[model samples]
Target chain A: MIDTLIWLVALPLASALATQLLPRYATAIVISTAIATSINAAALLYAVATHGVMLYQIGGWTAGLGIALRADGLSALLLMMAAIVLLASSIYASAYFNDNPLRRRFWPLWLLLWCSLNALLLSGDLFNLYVTLELLGLSAVALASLGGKTAALQAALRYLLVGLLGSMLFLAGVTLIYAGYGTLDLATLSRVVAAGPIAWSALALMTVGLLLKTALFPLHFWLPPAHGSAPAPVSAVLSALVVKATFYLVMRLWLDIFSEVVTPQAASIPGVLGAAAVLWGSWQALRAERLKLLAAYSTVAQLGYLFLFFPLLQALPAGAARDAAMGGLVILALTHGLAKSGLFLAIGIIQQRSGHDTIRDLDGTAQRLPATTFAIALSGIALIGLPPSGAFLGKWHLLAAAFSAGQWLWVVVIMIGTLLAAAYTFRVLGHAFGQQPYPRHPVTIAAEEWPALILSAFATIGLGLAGAPVWQLLKVSL
Target chain B: MLTAHWLYGLSGCLIMTFGLRAVLLNDSLLQRIIALNVMGTGVFMILITIAYRGPDAAPDPIPHALVLTGIVVAVSATALALTLIRRLTEEQDND
Candidate 1:
């Protein structure tokens, strides 16, 4: 299992270097690396399921002294989702960039980004997390600018700056922890972290830094442009996986590491911001002119739903209810990761076929590209939290927890957010039904379309039907 | 008791605040990028301050290691940002 964990990070990194050296075979290298990582991720998931949490220390050192990689059920599930999304996007990207010159550059950076995601998820040290976070940020920014357009460059620059600021703040917080607790390892820190000034201030600094990166409401200004302007595969991963990585760290600190240090009031801070994010982001999505912009803003809103889980979990005591709520959060995150990536790939197809992504101009798209439209509809259903999708189960748990905790405000926020999500999702789908000449064949370009369709179906139908194990997986934490 | 840690820590906080303010408010791209570097330096200073025990004693190596790694990351990020700025300027000039 530990070897599997090591290979999960090593394979992509090695492949990244290989692609850099052998640019001609970059496509083959990327595909093989993707397959290898997916297999490793599956093995890791299986190991976690059978054996519970697994921990690995580097260079035969102790936890407090050496770097550790820990994977419980949560990280494993996220790793699996990331692998699925990346693999699917890789297929889409291979076909999308068939003749494009940028494909060589994309392969190396894409692998580096994957490496960092895996590293960040498995890292058991706070300082190690910071390093991985920086790597993720840099690779993401580089990839975002791959389009070489003015808009893409501008957005990438802004993203790079914001990312730097966030990392600085997070580093300061980590320094404070080192000063107070005398250890950089999460397992050690979690045991030693107490409710006091050092803990409180450090948590505050780190949370704010993470919230900035997560783009929760007010700080979300840089997100739409960055995600919207990036090449489609980049945007899909950025929205689906990159932002969620930081949010995962925040959840780790609040729920797992600093559980004792965080007050309910402090927990509600993110929840309140999350509520605002839900409304504001959804409203922006509703008003966005372009399809990609709408998807980007919808990302902001969907992320808001994840944050809404914090306070509800805080209010619930340590029991089955809290566990169930946490499961809901993970399920929601997984669904969004799959569905949003699918939507982006489908939109990418639209943009490529029509030379633009203006939602207003998407007349008769369904007739022309039935498979892509179906992909959009399936992902849209997942996004709207409708029945048979994992998001529905997630929202059901969220509302139940809110009601049980007597937090009616969050209930109202969730209701409004769902309605707005429905409005925006259907707004895109509504364009599919416009009158135009239908193509003779429904599926054009099966390589590109199938990946999006499979991902969306997985999120909406597969995850929804088989969500029972998610709660069980949540119980297998360290 | 007034100590070296106090002085360095306070100065670090002040510098970080100033850098953050400039980064937030400055319009010039280069200035914002420099301010970000300044902000990173401040955080590194605090980490160094935390590592300092006494003149005679050997300092803790973990924070020092973290600071070094952080410097490398920051330097690369700055390079990336500057490259984007250069390209963007050229693009605007062409326009």
Candidate 2:
């Protein structure tokens, strides 16, 4: 089982390396990547289905001495989500960039991203996480700059600078941990670490660094430009996976190592920031003109919803807390991954057909691109927390958790976020329905439309159908 | 020697200050890369200093191993970024 787990990571990594070195067989390379990624996803799902957890040790060494790779329900679920989105993106990418010259670079970077994500999920030590985070950051910068426009390059440069500084801060924190306790592995650090000024300083440094990297409310200066302006597929991956890494690490670090550090007062900061992010990001989303910018700002908002789970998890009772609090965010992460990536892709297709993603300019796109319209409508239901989507299920559990814990302020934020979400989602939907002439630009867009609609349809409709299994599957929480 | 740790740490601190300066003030892309490399060197120095730890019990070689890996990865990324910078300049020139 452990060897199988290693193979799950190894396959994509090897494929990525092979693709980078051999650039001529672009089609075959993509096919190989798809097969490998699909197999990895299925294997993760299977691991979740049968075994409660999966573990692997590096270099055949023991846990404290060597790096360990362990996947509980949380890791497995996110890995599967990443795999599905990446596979879809790869398929969509294969067709979308057929005539573009940079298709070669696209395939390799995409594969490398897949590799980095798997490595990130599988890493068991802080040091290993840092390495994979750097890999993820570098590739994202390269891919964002792939647009070659000065705007994108400038955004990429900003992302790169911020990413490096964050990495350095993280590295310094890791060094402190190793110095303080002579171990950097999570399982060991959890057992041995004591509350002290050294550990607190390390935690503070790491918390600030990860929050900056994750683009939490005030530190989010670079995200809108980087995400809003990137190519559609690039935006999809960035939203679906990149930012999640920082949050994922924070979640893991808190649950596994920083249990003592999470004071009730300290935990509320995320809630406060989360609320601010929700209101501020939603307000911006409502006012934005470009479809992609709306979606990007919505990302900033959606990120707030994820953080709500943190404070909720702290406040709720243990048994229910694990299920409602953590489970709600897990579902939110998965659903948002599906829906946001789908939204980006759909917006991409619409942009190609209409030659723009501007709200005012999206005249008659819904009429001409009915599949894309259905895609947007379906994704909107989930986005707005309407029933029969994973977002609704997540919000339902989260609401129960909040009310049960008597956190009415959280309840208020959730309500306001829902209304704001509905407002923006329907703003696009209403625009889609309004009578306006299509733009005059001639368009070529056969390859782009299907994947976006398929992904969005799954995000909206599949959540309802798959609810029972998803609940059952995630019963084994972090 | 006891003096080695402080010496390496101080030098690392100095080089990192310059790296920070490069990242903040430099407009030239190549200069930024050079500063980034210098920053990597500072980090490498710190890693090595931490790995030393009084010369007992294999000297905590993990950070050492990570530093070597970091250097290789940094060089690879630098090569890629340089190429991108060149391509970007060419595109700008063309336009």
Candidate 3:
């Protein structure tokens, strides 16, 4: 299991270097790395499922001295989701970047991004988390600008600045944690962190920094352009996995480290912002003129749903109820990661085929591309929380929790957000029924279409039917 | 109560506030980027202050290591931001 953790990071890091050195075989290298990492992620998940939480301390030193890699059920699940999404997207990217000179650079940066995501998820020390966060930010920004367009470059620059600011604030928070507790290890800090000035201030600084990076509500202004303007595969992962990584850190801090320190009122702050994000982001998506822009705005709204879980989880006593709500939150996040990536890859296909992603102009193109359109529809169903989708189950738990907690306002917010999501989703699907003649065949390009189709189907059908294990996995911590 | 530690810590906070203010309010891209770097320096200062001990005592080594790693990250980020700015300027010139 420890070897699994080491290989999870080392494989991608080595592959990234190999791709840089051998650019001609970058595609082949990335494919093999993706397969290898996926296998490792599965092994980690299986090991954790069978043996509970696994911890690896580097150099045989204690937690506070040497870096530690910890994977409980939650991190393992997220790691698996990331591996699955990256593998699917890598397949799409291979075909998407075919015949383009950009593929040479894309492979290295893509692998670096994967390495950072794995490192960040497994990092047990606060300082190590900061380093991984910086790596993730830099690699994401570099990838975002690979489109070489003015919009892409400008958005990538803004993203870099915001990311830097967020990391600086996060580092300051870490400094305070170390100053007060004399330890950078999360487990040690969680045991010692109590309610006080140092704890409160560090919590505030870190949450604000993370919220900025996660782009919650008002801080979300930088996201749409950055995610929308990036090339297809880059946008897919940026929207799917990158933002979620920071949110995962925030969840770790709030629910795990600062569980006793954080007040319900404080938790409500993100909940309220999340409520606003849902309404505002969905509205923006409905009003967005382009396909990619709508998807980006929808991302902002989808993340808001994740934030809504914090308060509910805070209010619920630590019992089966809280565990269920936690499971729902993870499931929703996983569903969004899969569904959003699928939607982006599908849109990428449309963009490549039609040379534009204007929502109104997608009428004939949607019908002409049957498989991609089906992928979009499947993702749209998951996004709207329709039945037999993981999001439906997620939102079901959310509503039940809200009702139990007597939080009527969140219920209202979820209802309105769902309605708005339906409006926007159907708005896109409406294009598929246009007058243009439908393609005779279902699958056009198997390499590209299959990835998106498989991802969307998993979000809707695969996880939806088998989501009970999610709650069980949530129970398997050290 | 009034020691070098308090003074340095307070100054670090003040510097970080100023850099954050400029980064938020300033319109020039280069200025914002520089302001971000300034903010990072303030953070490093705070970390260094945290590492400080009495004149006779050995200081903590963790914050020193964190600061060094942070400096490397900040330098690389600044380089990336500047390269991006140059590219944007080149695009403008072409336009």
Best by lDDT: 3
For every model in order, the TM-score on chain A comes to: 0.99, 0.95, 0.99
RMSD of 1: 1.0
lDDT, candidate 1, at A377: 97
Query: Tens digits of per-residue lDDT for model 3 on B31-50?
Result: 99889988888888888888
> Model 1, stretches more than 4 Å misplaced?
none
Cα deviation of B90 in candidate 3 (Å)? 0.7
Give residue A220's lDDT in candidate 2 (0 to 100).
79
List model 1's recovered fraction of native interface contacts, to 2 decimals.
0.83
Docking class of 1: high
Kindly list the per-residue Cα lDDT of model 1 for residues A1-478, writing each as its tens digit: 5798888888999999999999999999999999989999999988898899988878889988889899999999999999999999999999999989998889999999999999999999999988998999999999999966788888999999899889888988998898888888998888889989999999988988888888888899999999999999999999999999999999999999999987889889889989999999999999999999999999999999999999999999999888889999999999999999999999999999999999898998999889999999999999999999999999999999998899999999999999999999999989777877788888999989999999999999999999988888778886
Task: Sort every candidate by DockQ, greatest first.
Answer: 1, 3, 2
- Candidate 3: residue A433 Cα off by (Å): 2.0
In model 3, state the lDDT of residue A67: 90
lDDT for predicted candidate 3 compared with the true structure: 0.93
Indicate the residue-level lDDT of B10 in model 1.
Answer: 95
Candidate 3 local Cα displacement, residue A68, angstroms: 0.3
